[model samples]
Target: MASRKRPALARLTNALATPSQLQVSQALGLSGSLLSSLHYLGGSLIQVAGAILNIPAPTIATSAIIFHRFHLVAGFLEQSIRDTVAACLYIASKSCEFPLRPSVILAAVDTACQDPLAVGGKRIPKRKYTRANTETLDHWELRILTTLAFNLHVVTPYTLCMEYLVSANVDRDRQKTVAQRAWNYLNDTLKTKICILHQPNVIAVTAIWLAAREAELELLDGEKWWEAFDVDTEDMGHLVLLLREGRDIAIRERDRIESGRKPTLTVEDVKARILEEASLSSRQ
Candidate 1:
């Protein structure tokens, strides 16, 4: 018999993928809840790592996007998610023109990993940066590069969002409120798959839409401002709903932590739970 051939990989892009193009985790029979938890965990790690490294927000956002895209192509089970998080930050920092040394990136990741709140209240022991650790990160960095096919140019929603706000010409008094809310919405979307699903322009418009409604500020003299941007009304509505769901998840996670519950699921915790559940199911 002729040797079996592997399935063709999906063409990678900065945004958009068809529903038929299942993520690697989905292909592995992972539950939706487990995948969501992992996505949130990775994003949180990127945020904390960025803060510890004093990297800029744009670079942090790019890192989160790269992290998600990498997992979408190569499942969390295939690679160490924590190490990938550090590697993504390292690659994004360079791509975003905010380069940091690998040693510095590793240090920041170590500190971020030690945060109990970020890691679902688990006390992760700090690991010293040995030659082995450096080699591991270098390997992950190359994996990300090849998995993503060197598509590192990520266009974020922040600049588009600011432009839309300026074009809308909101009242000077409420301008800051609207801008801040819109920015927060953009950041929250990073935690979910919304970033990969919609184009940056669409996401930016939707963010402004929600922010204006909350501030009770009308844009473009109460006309259909989104129409001017050529944004579909239906897409805006869909993004709004997605953003709401992400916000709810964030709030619940926060409350759970504050209430002193067992803490939200970390990537490692979720992986272990999934394996245990699979074992139990197999026995049954």
Candidate 2:
């Protein structure tokens, strides 16, 4: 028999093959690329939450932790996507010591979930969220807390990335730039399965590598960048590829939205479509 941890690991490893994943795939008619795009969309929610609340990088990390945990547990059956994202931010804000009003979190959620293609027009939320929705948001926060069992301990790679940059002899001024970009990459990684698959330090180093590459900052000569960290170069390299793929997905999502090739669908739309399809399939 598999150890107790094995089954849980198996479920998470094949996360997208689970019932919730299948429902989403069938509902969205999800291409692999579109699936990647959804993860990117989730990352954007964290970014918006951070910007609006002026939370630190660790708070952003906390938000991702909450976001991923909610999906891992409740999947698509629990709440509307925006509400879930907002609830995650709410919990993260408190946990990370950047408490925000429910209204502020909701506003950020609205901005995060906005379809860029609808820039010139009014956003079509599945429903409008006003201050009156505070009660509903309170309920959502409770649900997320219950689902996560209130275990909010998250050790993000933010600090590890800093140590790597300093050890690499990156100058103070450019270190800020490199660190900021690496921080963004770290937040982005939460949108991918890499978070669950890789160690925090490995992801941390890989984010630095990706940031340095994008900025054309040569932090090391040859492959010496891996020298200081106790991580396998091949594994870190693979993590880099995962982050890069997500970056590409976000870029492509942007391009598609800009070209007006298709209407943008919110999480609600996706969920509704899934329920509709499931209902129809049952009759057939």
In terms of lDDT, the best-performing candidate is 1
State every prediction's TM-score relative to the real structure.
0.86, 0.74
Angstrom error of the Cα, residue 153, model 1: value is: 2.0
Which pairs, if any, clash in model 2?
none
* Inter-residue clash pairs, candidate 1: none
lDDT by residue (23-63, candidate 1, tens digit) is 55666667777777777777777887787777777898899
**lDDT score for residue 169 of model 2:** 91
* Ten-residue region with minimum lDDT total, candidate 1: 1-10
RMSD of each: 6.4, 6.3
Q: Model 1: number of clashes?
A: 0
TM-score (C-alpha, index-matched) for candidate 1: 0.86
Deviating ranges (above 4 Å) for candidate 2: 1-35, 116-132, 173-177, 214-227, 263-265, 276-284
